[model samples]
Target: MTHPSTDTATSALPPLIKGPHERRLGVVALVATLGGLLFGYDTGVINGALLPMTQELGLTSITEGVVTSSLLFGAALGAVTIGRLSDAWGRRRTILLLAVLFFVGTINCVSAPSFEVLVIGRVLLGLAVGGASAVVPVFLAELAPYEIRGSLSGRNEVMIVSGQLAAFVVNAIIGNVLGHVDGVWRIMLAVAALPAIALFFGMLRMPESPRWLLSKGRNEDAVRVLSTIRSPERAEAEARDIRATVALEERTTTAGLGEVLRNKWLVRIVVIGIGVAVFQQLTGINSILYYGQVVLAESGFGAQAALIANIAPGIIGVVGAFVALWMMERVNRRTTFITGYALTAICHFLIGFASVSVPTDSAARPYILLILIVAFVGSMQTFLNVATWVLLSEIFPLRIRALGMGISVFCLWVTNALLSLYFPTIIGTFGITGSFFGFAAVNALALVAMIRFLPETRGRTLEAVEEGVTTGAIFTIRSRSRHR
Candidate 1:
């Protein structure tokens, strides 16, 4: 029989308690988020590392594209493949495996004597990065108390951007201090292994996902694990809710591939999740980061000055992510997403309108666009990026959470990779005006799609989320039930 008190159990979580229990959960999230740090570092390091690497490796344009893009394509592969692996093997074990991959990949890149070897090493690291991207937030979400789950899981996004900022700073300092050193890029590659080492050792002491355990019928183990993170009273209550939900899923949810196609809710939620993931990229944020220098140069800045100015967005990105984290605790996620997408769309339109309206020779044109680009970056990091990841982590039912996240993120990467490959050609053919106009259109459509399909996820337990999402009840405000 269900305990009457169990219904109010989730509400028992005190927001921002700052107690020992909160500290313990915070530590676990930090340890796991090292994967995110590695993700950011590995991706961003290439921005600076590529120049020196090409000088030493004798890379042609085609090969250079290959080297720069190998990780992205590899990340797409890793997100899908490792995502399934986590579902079966478990989130913690999969992350530990990712740690090993990160270490091996870093060493391989640092030691590679040829372009082929370096590309191979980059692909290996991409797998780890993609794996971490999929699993870390999910791991944190499962362990977090509902009251602070948004802030807690959001730490991964903060770490990712922070890691990117760290890479930019590290690359700048190392390249300057040892500007003449041979193979300095190798030293840059070597820095990632330290965090990988930390992630591996840190996760060793962490507990498995209690929700995963509950789904697997390890009831006592689930409650025991929860006890460490939650007060004993709340742990028992949350476990009961999870147990009941899992049992219901076992009985009613049988959507294999063919069945999934037949099942409207299954198909709808998966499709919605994929769209949500892809929409984040369609905002043209990654396209901007990838080609910020090109945009700056077109604005008439000198190469070195453009290079330095580009860091402004990266710095603002980090600041915005922290703001997003603090806001995550206070704001509803749907509100944040719609607000962000709307803001970015407006910024993109203004950029397009300005690019055409203002004379290219005008001195103020560059500064005007620069401010707009920074605002666009700020809006994205502050609202869309972190929320997208956090939403991806928690939106699916437990049965298909990793798989849903994997496929969605795979599409997200594929979209990002596509933009990266073709963005230069886009600007070449249509110039900045046409390209950003296209971006504005895409974001506008995305905003509508989201408002129509996106569900409110704030202040819900994983079990509550699973119930609402799978049944299609979450999309309708009044239809959604509050767990508390």
Candidate 2:
């Protein structure tokens, strides 16, 4: 039944194009993931710098929370706006704009003299971070082959952890070496500017998302871009496939917000997307990234040592993401999410237990608490973070991909904002144990929700997954052939 043109197009693909090729895939993913790295650095930089910033800015407990949450609130807004913008402007251009935002935000944060100024800077940075969070994975997913899409898209998560690790290490060094200096936190906050610059300059040379190009009526350009990254044959075939799907979008003018609300299926999918995004953040991962050093200090570690110890969790988070990438090819999305939630919940309980049971003055307290914190990061990054993003990228239909992902990620950032706002108060009142116990309880509930609702989206082509979601034809497939 296949046409000769289809056969020829398929034949032109190189062997690596047909399946997962680590070297080829890794290189491409790494370049695109620099956006994620900058995101991590900007967000994580605050954890170490907050102490100095608070002292210099004369911030109260509430003000501190506000400063931290402002970025997240900005991110929440950015996720929604930029997500739709990426759909209209193309992923690469959207990313380029985000890179510019990062640069401008960094400059603002580094030079800010007042609390209001600092808050403004953080909010701008949050916008860039939020935009990058939504767009990077989608861009990578659009470029990757189906067989390897999970790992390729997950490269952003890996870079995120790596960026966090780098921030922690830099924070420790800067805080220690410049301990005696006035406003030492400025140096720490300023470190983020370099990566933002790099991301902007580097993205100038990157290719546009082939899928986005096709959607925008630039089919020939999409094929040419795909050919460089994919085998010639695979590129042609994918272009044809994308062309086929674009034809469907052409038949429907379903892009309006009102149209999205009117469609039962789109609304259902959007709700699922929002749940996925919010649940991932509600697990309390960012609390640790933003406040781990403070938690460690509460556990009785000295300021200097706690700063160094915080890097351990950052390192573990990155390693866990790499492991997640490996498992992405083998595990179902539902299974991975369930497993992640269970693990983080258990870790939270353990942390809470350690906090309550261990005497504050005991030498063993900080070490034991540190172990629990690392475990929490490990469980989150390995099982939930990468899987959540990958699922978001694949589960929605092409027509509503940007809208759905934006809305979901907006919920995610808002959840993050709420947690960031309340985290210090929770820790201050209940100590580390009570705070973690709270996270554990919330995570347990999230696990049940995921089991009941989250669909397995790994290992399927975007077109196939979109078809499945739109038609309600299939929920889970053990083999690719069944997807067709």
TM-score of every candidate: 0.93, 0.93
Poorly placed runs, candidate 2 (over 4 Å)? 1-28, 476-484
Candidate 1: tens digits of C-alpha lDDT, residues 374-459:
99999999999999999999888888888888988888888777777677778889998999999999999998987777878887
The global C-alpha lDDT for each of the candidates, from Candidate 1 onward, is 0.84, 0.84
Best by TM-score: 1
In angstroms, give how far residue 126 of model 1 lies from its true place.
1.2
10 residues in a row with least lDDT, candidate 1:
1-10
- Which ten residues in a row are the worst by lDDT in model 2? 1-10
Q: After superposition, how far is residue 230 of candidate 1 from its true place, in Å?
A: 0.9
Native-vs-model 2 lDDT? Answer: 0.84
Candidate 1 clash figure, as a count: 0
For model 1, the superposed segments whose C-alpha errors exceed 4 Å read 1-18, 254-256, 478-484
